[model samples]
Target: MGKEFIELFEQWADHYDETVTGHDLEYKEVFRHYEAILAEVAKRTFGHVIEFGPGTGNLTEELLKRGRTVTAFEPSPAMRNLAQEKIGNRAEIKEGDFLSFEFKKSVQSIVSSYAFHHLTDKEKAEAIAAYGNILESGGKIVFADTMYESVEAYKQAIKDASEKGFHNLAEDLEREYYTTIPILKEMLEANHFTVSFEKMNDFVWIMEALKK
Candidate 1:
């Protein structure tokens, strides 16, 4: 799972909201239109939802406002604490990760925002396959996170980040499991999902994959 970054997330627990709100210039672009992106994800989701990596419960809040039942899984204890503090008893914010979460009820939609990059491509595939097995026909997976259109675009993003003296951003781009559209499409399709993408920002794309 993404537990490897628990320490980092624990350290970032307090400042995470600040970074997402454009307080950190290096990551500003990465989190641009932060609220709107959460809103868009919430709008696309329906019925019972399982949210992976619900950091600080931002999207959880949106989903709750829409009157949707949400069960959020987060790996970091610190992040989970913050999310629980933010969401209260409205939604169950549990300690789990993308590939290691558990829920008894069948869900209509599986959603996430700005957190899927924690898994490598192989892990991503495994997670998708697992979801495919659980979800019935017409169930959906709505995720919004950093993704590139092509390998060249991925490289160019890192280059641009480097040239702009955004070493942290550049390093993060190079370090994370951020992947390309083609690869994700193939993975989703192999798992019986009909996927579509919409660019949310220079660094983020909304992937809506409906299980067939």
Candidate 2:
């Protein structure tokens, strides 16, 4: 799975930020929201921040600018190369997916921008629990990603996409599992983390949770 996306993203590394910014409907207006989440984390800790899928270093650059060191879980070679070029020594770039990646040490905060949607439902829960294991007490998590309101809403979205002649897009959505804020809140709370949510738009949300 990681190998396949790595090869696919290797081709997109150069133009990722530009193309995804305007072309991806679910991602439109997400940059500002990401910055807000980063700022929230910045207010909490000055320690290293763990980031999953730091593609092209858009959010990585922001975290570095705020003086937060980043440990990136990025699997794409080309993407990692570009991110390194953009971020320099400000980040620790590790090439792997979140499911297999482990923290070498405790970090005060964990963040992912538009990356969590890549995980399946079961994987997402595991990842959330793993996040708790890696963080110190009161450690913060700021996740900004494309999310549906519910599984049912995702189903309706697919139906609407199909009706609008986006058959291929509908199929893609069916294959990938995204999340809703409420469901994410439940998962976090079940892991003993307190949670809150802020929306960027209809699909993008900033989910903030703190480890208890």
Model 2 per-residue lDDT at 177? 64
lDDT of 2 by residue, 131-158 (tens): 8888999888888777877778877877
User: How much is the lDDT of residue 172 in candidate 1?
Assistant: 85
**Segments in model 1 whose C-alpha atoms lie over 4 Å from true places:** none
lDDT of 1 by residue, 170-201 (tens): 99898888999999999999988999999988
Best by TM-score: 1
Q: Estimate each model's TM-score.
A: 0.98, 0.84
TM-score for candidate 2, residues paired by index: 0.84
- Residue pairs with colliding backbones in model 2 are none
Provide the lowest-lDDT 10-residue window in model 2: 26-35
